[model samples]
Target: NRRGLPEGHADVKRMMTVPIMRNDEIVAIVGVGNKAFDYEAEELEVFARYADSVWDSIQVKRVEDALWQSREIYRAVVENSTDSIVRCDVNGKFLFGNEAAIKLLGGAEAAPIGKTPEELGFCPAFRHTWDASLQYVVAQGFPASFEFDMEIAGRTQTLDMRFAPEYSPTGRVVSVLGVARDITERKIAERELARREEQYRVLTETMKDVVWVLDIESSKFRYVSPSVYALRGYTSEEVVALPVDHAMTPEDRAALKALTLDRVAEFESGSLAADHFYVDQFPQPCKDGSVVWTEVVSNYYINPDNQRLELRGVTRDITERRQAEVALRQARDTLEQRVEERTRDLTRVNAELAAAMQVKDEFLSVMSHELRTPLNAILIMSQVMLEGVRGSLNERQLRAMQTITESGQHLLAMINDILDITSVQAGTVVLDRALHEVDALCAPLIDRLRAEAATRSQSIDYVCPSEPLYLWADGRRFGQIVRHLLENAMKFTPDGGQISLFVQPDLDRRVLSVRIEDNGIGIAHDAIERIFQPFTQADSALSRQFGGSGIGLTLVRHLVELHGGTITAESAGMPGSGSRFTVQLPWQAPPVGSPHGAILAAGAVHGPHVVLIADDNPSAQRVMGDALRAAGYEVLAALDGIEAVATARLRPPDLILMDMQMPRCDGATAIRRLRQLPACAATPIVAMSSVVVPNDRALCLDAGADDYLAKPISADTVVDVVARHLAPGRSLIDAASGADARPS
Candidate 1:
């Protein structure tokens, strides 16, 4: 049996088996016996053909089984899917629908197989769209998608529907398979996100603080709010185009860069929390070249777009807050110093106390300048009008103009009193002493107050020496002392009261004594010294009864002390007993043959002197020009220092009245520049300014000005200054502006 030879014919000699197949399945087996010889190729070939048929049938059955299995899997997947899946015929009739589809159509009642979307109670508005999509898919043999809103279970549902053409064996589109996703919840979320974004936009746009986002990698702003213009003086687009540290100074920029690097290191090291915020304060430079302190609150976040860490910050100006903190600290320091020096000598304590009170002097200086700048125009213009410079005025107009001038002067006095008290207490007042006549000072002051007394039905009587009384004193302070005493008399005295002034000269002691008496509201004996204190009236009730700042006598006493004189106040402690103030001054005459021995008259004017008035205020320029023109001088005005320099170079002036504070080029700078010019070198330059302080005149004079004039200058002062400065052929006699021109 191991060899090719038959082991044994066996019991039956030869046998063969054949497999019978039906539909590729083995139905039966047949056996044949007594075969003659071994099968030849021809016989075997026929048998092989039958066997090949059976193999073919088996292959076909395998393919059919696999296709059926694939169909079953596809059906299972379609049924389990959450999306609504359905098939429609070319005419839009439903061929099959899954459970999701039935649920989408409201319990299968509204939608059923073999029914079109319209026939199955679909939205009428969507019916045409559905039919059109089906037709398009059928015609183009391509897939299509659309979205529509529908009602399901008594609620609105938004569906995103896709249609694909189902092809036949011949590649012809038979029906459309639709898959719809109910995106109702997704749409609601999207709408809510949009609304919240709009609300955020509104908040950031309208707020005062600037909100911005920075791209860390680019080191530039990614988004900047419109409010950036207010905080840093840059537009939103402009800021976005700039570097993040553009508004920072060089030192600040370096610090900020270092801080950012540290923050980044902290973030990468996991030492900083993801939602941590930072607060920073620094000085930021503005577009206008000014610097302001700002507070920045920021947080780090990863931008979803680039998946990179970025900074979102809110910036607000804190310059005013910083100033307030500084002021508070200064106040604390001042309080400590006051307590420490409380037991020192009176003079030393006073000087130190004055130094401590200099904190508000800067603010007072600014306020004084601003108030006096406009007031200069008002007073000067009113004076010019009253003098009939422009034209003649009727009686009514003259009276009105006089009232305006008086009111303006009253306001000026009050302002000066406030400033003078500050200056005197601070011990910063410097006297510009000059020769003055007692008659000239007392007579005009008496005349000035006579009208006010008449209005109150009061009579003011004054006695002066028949001969001119001469003394060495500051004319302005001398007048102020007398004016305050006169005003005090008028303030305390009742209507129809009598006020008297007695000027007595004692040549034996080289002293002059002046006495003023009022017949109403006498001071108490105990408060005689107290009345001379700053901001103290004789009686507390008198403050409300008579409207006065109560610093008049205080200023008067300080001024008299500054003049090397003594003043005394006497009262009888009884009403109607009257009050008397006596001031005594030791006189010193000018040296014989000295020019100061005689009052310098405004010498003769040879020619129409060309005077330049340089001021920034339009009204001030106009008034000064008119006043100079009325005084027989050719006047030219420049709005600012730059123009003044240019004008002076073009047409040289005999005298230049330059304002200290002006736009572009200031008076100090202009004067210094003008002095370099050959034509202006010898020209008389008088510096004028509204800011009245001890050092202001020095500053003006140091700027190459021959003299300085304080603001609210009367026409007489201007004329006298011009005449004295421009007297024939530049024979300089007394470079002083005027004896009466005093800066408060």
Candidate 2:
């Protein structure tokens, strides 16, 4: 009955119900007494105004609810963040701090709302710097960040801090918001990483091995060691420009890549064990287009920056080692063939076994000569290359040649040593007996030893008499004995330890007592007696740690005995306790039949250092004499080789300048004859000739000249040649640097 009708009209049919009008109040009510619509236009307009008012209130409520939710979300984000966040006014009062901020400031007591940085007791360090930074940001209205250290809760912390100004609507910075991160652990880690990088850099640059790092993704070398120059004849920078396969043959490269990729795949798929490395050997081309055998070892690791796997490894040029193995194999095959042939004639072989041993000894001597010949050439050529004889060389090439020369010299020394020991053992060392001045021989050796000692921070205290101690023995072999003892002392001595060599003469006994003592690692009591035995050492482990031929002492003992002498060793067997080696040799004074002893005296030189010039060519002799005279050297001219030797013995010059070819006797013959005299034994003799070839120099050296100089010689060349040979120390240490570690 009341449908579409005003409320309260159900009971009374004529009743009119209108909502109470409070200007803009209710337009309608659910139970209001119904008012019949007798509509006036103004009345409807008033109703519309009331409806709009109701809609306005509801919209206001919705907006307020939405803003409440947004504030809550922002509050949650600030609280949950790991970063320490704080909001402060321009005066540096803490307006607000998040959870992380409170925790970082030692939980709430040290830092709280309205408290300034000065009030934060948990982290007093960096307070001044932090305050300054905040003030700057507030004044400048800019963002700033810095790293500083802080003492926090008994631990030192490195903080990464940032400050930003929060502006008001008027564009003024009212407060500064700061964020601090404790990056203490990170900074320590970074420092450790830097230390490791520097260590590796030093190792690679100094090591003889060639280490490399490669970018697998780019298929390029990223890092190459400086030592690559020695192995491949290429500079590190040059190697970086080369592709990984640039030096490999196509087939080898393909095979290598296939194996490498298979390993990589296995690693990625977890089929390969962790930390497994790959090993390979292949022939690689050098800068000179020669092939070298290389042994490579490598492993893959991910690059932290790009997250890509890379290759890092060391390579060794094993060409020499491989060549030696081949030679040994060839020698074995030859021996097996000879053995089979001898087996067919065993009866004949038994009859000539002693003869066969003699042949073997001769063969070894010939082999030694053959080896030295090429080695001399190699040493000369390497010197030429190092000096840029053909053209100027870069640093890499120079260093490479230096290493080559050093290695060649060391090999030559080893060959000489082995051959000598073999010859002595086989009773084939024929002594070319002559008068040798111990003092003169020791001069050059001590100089060499001092150079060696300087590298190890060791010192040699050598004391000998001013007078020459003449020994009638093989001069070369005697020199070898002293050198071996000195080298042995140096090898065993620790850094900063002292090695003492004293040569004392026993006039009554007609003998010399040479003592070489070192404060070093000593020998065991049981091993002292056996030390002179060939191939025997105090401990085998020492032989491995400190490399030796195991024949050094054996050679020393034999050489000493060969000169009618005896050698002995004494040690306490305690670590850091020293050992002493004593050698006694028969000391024979020089021949007294000649009156040349006065001229041979050390202080007898009254003029410029005397030099003997011997040349059969009349014009040549004059030119040589004039050159020597112009250089402030007293010249003793000899018309021929025969006269040269006689004159050198009579007038013991400081130097002998000899021509290779002369009448009646050659320079070689003259040198040999002069060397036999005690007065001329250690004189510096230089050969001047048109031939500067290595063979000619070797021949002259074999004949006992100190050095060789080609003819067309200038006065300056003569002076320098004389000066060097007179001193005879051209830093041989640099030539045999690596070998100095082992006793010769």
Q: Top model by lDDT, which number? A: 1
Question: What is the C-alpha lDDT profile of model 2 across 1-744, one tens digit per residue?
Answer: 447748753654333234534468864542222456555657556665665676667668989999999999988988998888999898888898899988876787664788776776535557777777888898788999989787766888888989999988999888888888889999999999999999989999999889999988788899999998988899999989988888587669888888878878877887666578888889988899888899999888888998988989989988998999999999999999999888869967775886887788788778888988999999999989887897888989888998999899778877878888887887778666544567877878999989989989999998998766654456788789889999899999989889999999875554688999999999899999888898888899998988787788998998876655789899888998999999987553433443234323311222245678887777776555544443334467887789997887667877788898877898898999999999889878888777767698788888898888877877557766775654422111111121111110
What would the per-residue lDDT of candidate 1 be over residues 352-444, giving only the tens digit for each residue? 766767657877888899999998999999999999998999999999999999888888889989999989987788766544678888898
Model 1: lDDT equals 0.81
TM-score of 2: 0.40
TM-score, one value per model: 0.42, 0.40
Model 2, which residues run further than 4 Å from truth? 1-35, 119-125, 215-218, 250-271, 300-311, 337-345, 349-744
Which ranges of candidate 1 are over 4 A from the true structure? 1-36, 109-111, 169-171, 304-306, 323-744
- The top-ranked prediction according to TM-score is 1
lDDT of 2 at 716: 55
